[model samples]
Target: MSTLTHMKPRALNLLLLLSTLPVFAQKPIIGIFESTSSGAGDNQGQPGVRVLFYQSGRQWRSYNAICQDEACLKTIVHLYPPVTTWTLFKQGKPVAKVAATTPTAYHSYSEIGVQTITNPAAVLHLERRSTPDYPDRPHAILATNLSHLTDPDNWQPAAVFPLDLTHVIQAFHKLYPHPKNCTQNTTNSPSNYHDSTYPDSQIKMDSSYLSNKTNWRMLQITLGGYLCDGPPDDAYVDHWFAISPTGEVHHLGRLMHLAGAADFAREGHSELLFQVQGGNEAGYKLFYDNFTHQAQDTVTYH
Candidate 1:
């Protein structure tokens, strides 16, 4: 009756044993991938995030006909998208379920259930367990959230947290009162010169690396008009300044161009570094770099 109810007990036992092996012995695909995101950071020339994921190490592309075997195909069918809550299984039991958001972009594409990681571990136990190709040795796996994973330049560092400089701005305004000449002379009217009413909205503020140390707060300030409003002759004077915790405001220089260091954070140094432009010290320079962390100065006499 219908092939004798599927066969003899011994044959059924053999089939069950074979099916159980793949389930218990199977591994997961776990590694890091690069993702590209756009916004403020993108406008400022920094736009990349690293995506990490750990899931059943089953590959969908099957060039080999033998891989079409029922057991292997069954495992692939169960996997699904936005793999946010993926279980970390140990000894055939769920240990931990890690969750992560899937970043989306106009040009980026990600796996349905793959997670993301900012800094990946050098060696992942799950990766070593799942990858039989290097069962004894650990190797870094290369993957990406982009359709084309070969280009590193396509991915920049992840977005930074929003910078807050309210306290520093208030302190600076309090210590260094605006000049009276700014408002009295309406001919080349310096609107905000004495105006402590400087529209809090106009000034862009960010904390420099030097402030990262404990009890040491330093901030970088950029005062300028809107990009579309062209250069301000007298109504505005675009300049840069550094405010120390003690309310010591130091005028670093003026805004030169859109080109300048994104932030001192990139250098990992927590001190003021700047270059003087268009003055008696026209060709003079001062900065911190490979030579020393201490500020160094040099001048070129034309």
Candidate 2:
């Protein structure tokens, strides 16, 4: 009788479109979500959201191959942890859910690996979505209660305006010659000293275009200025570009500046989480790539 009421109707619409698709077997944990305070310009010394987290061993070995049986796995608080909970994306979905006590020896330091997330309701959900009418940047993505859809928003931004690195720093000095510091000046001239230069764009990167080619656009290049006057060590030292939708840039790294950017390794594109300011303040940096076939996120954060 149960089998009789079945079949037909395009096989039940192809079994309801195969249930609904999108599962990918869990593997998607790349986190970094700073809370609020200071963003009207000057003095962004945020002293609220703490309980760190670097958590990026190539997205915990590509999602630890869907858990390798440790009695089913799900309790990864840190220290010998590989996968458990990290469902706190923004601009995509899944508002809050993070865990990692930060235990490291530095094996996946694409940006100096060392995971941590104190999690106090994600600092009261980033202070009630940064009330007072929500301004814009304090690494803001604010607004979320989170109670469903586990993991789903890829951090959308393939093209929305922003790609002017003032000429990709002469192809980043002929594609990598980064050595000659002590302020001789000439890495875009921030002096031999770098404490600040960020003109903005500390957030916007979710790339993976191994030739998927839509013109390869993933940028956050801010040229700005900060001629090393002393004591301001981290502003625009963060340059990550990949223009070419007919523009052509492609540098990829300078590091520093970014509180969040995910896709972790769900491999749809995204793996950037930088937040290590002036002389390692708690430390964190994971760049990760998929522009072609380059891997990162654990080269040394030890």
Candidate 3:
């Protein structure tokens, strides 16, 4: 476990040799997400879920991320929760509806701390309550699911939420209800020249810039990246904010058609260089400095 920058000559040569060898990357998993609703109206605690779309042998299973711990970090599996019913809608018209013979829940005997559902579609509209304390808040999928991963002709902005002046967390949700039909991003964007620094898989990237070069660390959200499938169908958005060293939260503007971060600098103590798609500043480069907690325009291409 060595950082790439500090590798010895032999190690660097070995790494380069390995790179030229043919290696197959894992295929993208299809389903999984954080719980948005918990049968209750008000959700609580740190969001801890690792919903999985994977294959166990020849059987395809859904490892739904559910809570089962005193600390709330540990997870448990519910294998093949009975598909009680199936309702179909065609062109927004109800076509057919059916139900299963028996309703049940199968708890796994494995203490490995994982849940698998044989019926992958059962949890399509699933929600769960982590504890009785947060009875009103149902922890479930906040955005769309796998089914909506479509092409440009098939997809559009299913919903939008606004970020206003008030520091109230509840206000943001009032403007934009949690995205229900969107899929949760599962891949961690790589930070390298050869590999992409952005996520590009069936499940996209749901990232928060938790820490960076400035050492301005706290539990405050600064930057968030949400993505859609690539180009023509390339739908993406970004949320920006600033957290002072003393713990003050400053909400910045949201980029509607954010392209990508073109460049980032650590020499100046972590600066973000990116682009946007529309409005008066159509082709301008926005340089955001993490040390000063401010964003300034560096170049104008419009």
Worst lDDT 10-window in candidate 3: 37-46
lDDT of 2 by residue, 140-210 (tens): 33111123332222333444343334445445435433322234334445445433222224323333322
lDDT by residue (1-302, candidate 1, tens digit) is 33223333443443344355454453322222222222221111121222222221221111111112223322221222223333332222333334434333111111212334322342233343423574223212333222211211121222222332565455445543442323333443445344333555666653343433322333455544422223343223444444444645554445321111211222243222233333322211122232123222222122
> What CA RMSD would you report for each candidate?
23.7, 19.3, 22.8
The whole-model C-alpha lDDT of candidate 2 against the native structure comes to 0.38
Residue ranges of candidate 2 with Cα displaced over 4 Å: 1-87, 90-169, 174-238, 250-254, 257-302
lDDT of each structure?
0.31, 0.38, 0.28
TM-score of 2: 0.25
Which rank order by TM-score, best down to worst? 1, 2, 3
lDDT of 3 by residue, 1-302 (tens): 33343333443454364356443433222221223211111122212122223323322233322223222221111222222233322222232333321112212221111122224344454445345685333222311111222111121111212121223233233323333222434333232112112222322222333333333322212122343223211223444444444555554445422222211221222223223334333221232344343332211112
Q: By lDDT, who's the top model here?
A: 2
